[model samples]
Target: MSWSEACHLDRSLLSLEHFFSIPPDYAQTLTGGLTNRCWKIVTTDNKSFVWRPATHITKAFSISRFQEYQILSAIESSHLSPTAIHINDQGLLVDWIEGESLTDSLSFDSLLQTMIKIHDLDTQRLPLAPFNYTARVDHYWMLLSDEHKVPAFAEIYNRWRTAPNLADVGLSLCHFDLAGYNMVKTEQGNKVIDWEYAALADPRLDLTLSIDVMDEKPLEAVYRYCQLRGIEGVDDWVEGVLAWKPRATMMAMLWYLLAYQLWGDEQYLTQAEKLQQAFCS
Candidate 1:
């Protein structure tokens, strides 16, 4: 039987049926990021939720789906995200939150506050993966070594690598790819979706990774993050996040390339070029 067919038979996997007391009649694919195949599953009675299955997209930074499921299972009570009703090796079922995604001014204070809540979660209960930017950049560069644009990306990153960093780093739960669209502002508050790239790292590092989708500078957010948390060494935090900007930019370019390669769309290639020139020159 196909996966969907098996989903209908397995009571544990078909929690949506149990949750709503109705069987799912159809699942509609939701469009956005190229990393995962997502669906909005609606039951016969109109109850709905998201069913996202992990994909095997190589030449991109490796993502541990198992870790993602673990974090989601742990944070259901935290309310930083939609409650994960069920999770299996295939994926998880979470209520489809209804709200507008944050827009206009790119600096989302609510998103930052939600991030603070996430960072404050006890590390002992929720484990996270190590995030090393240099090593990750080198790995992606190696994967796309033949691509000329990425080499230019690597060269600029080499220059940024010389900057001094803090001797001590504050580690916390980090959503490495915090694209603005990944955040959904519901009645409950700002809930960050997508934990595929979530890990344990310098919270500042996570801030840098998020700048890809933001037009604002890191200084304001960095200062606010420090002030709210009573954190010292404000300049070091800003500098550290700034240093990771190029690496983040490079990772976006790599995703664009992969999108182009997979979909055969010229727009992806064009976007990759625009982002590459913005940083490399």
Candidate 2:
């Protein structure tokens, strides 16, 4: 069912006979994410599942859905991800992971270590695309306007394009978006969710992105994390991380701008301006 239709179903008011025969009676509502609507449903049997109704735009949303399913299936056994229960011709449904987001509670040291472990995972058994940060950044730059944001974007983009390869830097699977909001602190440890933008790329890109989202002592956290991973010559890695900041910021700005245009919310535009300021500065 579409997300809107699912949200309108009330478990308390409606008899279980009206809807599709799932074991339990449930209620759903639009929750999480800025683009797609997610419905959280609890069955009468006490089983829970999340229903993500597909968004109309095929380029971003649809492609992301397909990519997420592919990546999750490829990495399901790494012990670092959520279980993708089922995806079919209709929609995507997965087990609802319950836990607190690691956004505020995560230490920089721990996060960096987690990232290293993630990047170090063996990928020979899985078929996935290679991560080319330079190419991805170029894609974002192409979408940017030449008048207001071109020069600033080009400056940062060039640095990442030609960044030197560091020792022990190996390309492996990467969770492109590893922000606190996407991480869940479960009983087993931290489980990463929201795999839409994952790729096989430089591990440093993940570190850089996470550093951008860190509110407390970002640089210190990054350095410590690098050290723990036995990553030598951290100064070079730091440069790479800094070089990646503008591209990441601009990409986010573009997303927010697009979201604003689609949803017609001035707040998105405001947030985009703020991101631009950060990028330019």
**RMSD per prediction, one decimal?**
4.4, 4.9
lDDT of 1 by residue, 221-252 (tens): 78887787778888888878777676677667
Best-performing candidate as measured by lDDT: 1
Model 1 Cα shift for residue 200 (angstroms)? 1.0
Maximum-TM-score candidate: 1
Backbone clashes in model 2, listed as residue pairs: 24-44, 25-44, 131-200
Q: How many backbone clashes does candidate 2 have?
A: 3
* lDDT of model 2 at position 50: 64
Error of 1 at 181 (Å): 1.6
